[model samples]
Target: MVEDETDQVTLDLEQFEETKKEDTKPTLGDIFTDRVESLMKHRDIDNVLDDQQHILNNLEMMNEKLKFLNLISQSRYEASVTAFRFHMRLLSGVKKDLDSVFRRIRTLKTKLGVQYPEIMAEVQDKYTVHVSDDDDDE
Candidate 1:
């Protein structure tokens, strides 16, 4: 009777072991395929980063423009004076940029003249007066 009971117990343990394997873990190939799918995405991650940088640059420009509006809103006097002053400042910046560009062109012309004097003979300083630094005194 005892021997028969021991044999039955071993058979039951074997059946349990077979049932346990049905709820198996994922294989290495399954994990590797999932990783490969992520790596093979249609859009690269850099595109998202570039989009964010563009948005930030635009937002920074808008913020600078809005600062003028905020300053004018807080003033007790009429906004025309403040606005005119701001416009003058903006014009001054434009003049400075134009002056720098003119200087750069002059430098480039000089460099070119050193190499080939004949090419710069007709290239006169037409924009020099407009971009003069005298206006900055006011």
Candidate 2:
């Protein structure tokens, strides 16, 4: 009977060990959860470096764009203004030349009128031109 009791105790110890092992063993879900927790706790340096590189590239592109805009504002705008001023001066000189030409033509006509008064009167009577307001009843 004593030997039977010792065997019974040995059997109970074996069963307890099996139950303890079953309770402590990790499942697939437990392992996945532990990995995710570990990853969350750790900081990855490569991602931070990538983000910094992106910011630097964006700033460089913006700097190049600003340089192009400055070129247009400085050289192109100043050149346009200078060209406009030159054209205006040229137009003014042309106007002065045209005025002098018209004055010379008027003086020549007066001299011809003074030389032949009777012939000018005959031509004027034949032409019969008039300047009217109301556009000739258009």
Candidate 3:
């Protein structure tokens, strides 16, 4: 009787483990669907934000280098001109990347509007800059 009870308990434990594994095994279709949703939601936003931040950082660095080049060029003309040209090219590339980032962010915001309206609003509000008309009109 003791042996039979132990066997039954072991069997019950094995069944419980099997059930837990079955519950945890996400179906291929379910996994694919989740991946697609994530791509549409978090991944797209993250990629755009990362790209934008990268370009912004590069542009900032280039601006600093340009300032340094200006100071150095005052002393050394030819080297400074070359450095200025290189920095200008880098600035142009950064601008193009920024344009792409803005376009992607816009598209992502529109796509996520229905499902994540609050998130869309928060992102728009957070990232937007209100321009004040403080300059005198000539």
Q: Output the number of the lDDT-best candidate.
A: 3
1 or 3: which has the higher lDDT?
3
Q: Any idea what lDDT model 1 has?
A: 0.81
Pairs with backbone N, CA or C atoms under 3 Å apart (clashes), candidate 3: none
Write model 3 residue lDDT over 1-138, tens digit each, in one string: 999999999999999989987889788998999898876878787899999999999999999999998888787887778899999999999989998999998787688998899987897788986766996532
- Measured against the true structure, the TM-scores of the candidates, in listed sequence, are 0.33, 0.45, 0.34
Clashing pairs in 1: none
As for model 2, its CA RMSD to the true structure in angstroms is 15.4
lDDT string for model 2 (43-128, tens) is: 55567778999999999999999999999899988999999999999999998999899999879768887999898788778886
- Give me candidate 3's TM-score against the actual structure: 0.34
lDDT of 2: 0.88
Write down the worst ten-residue block by lDDT for model 2.
39-48
Per-residue error for 69 in candidate 3, Å, reads: 20
Look at candidate 2 and tell me the lDDT of residue 48. Answer: 76
Q: How many residue pairs clash in each candidate?
A: 0, 0, 0
Best-matching candidate per TM-score = 2
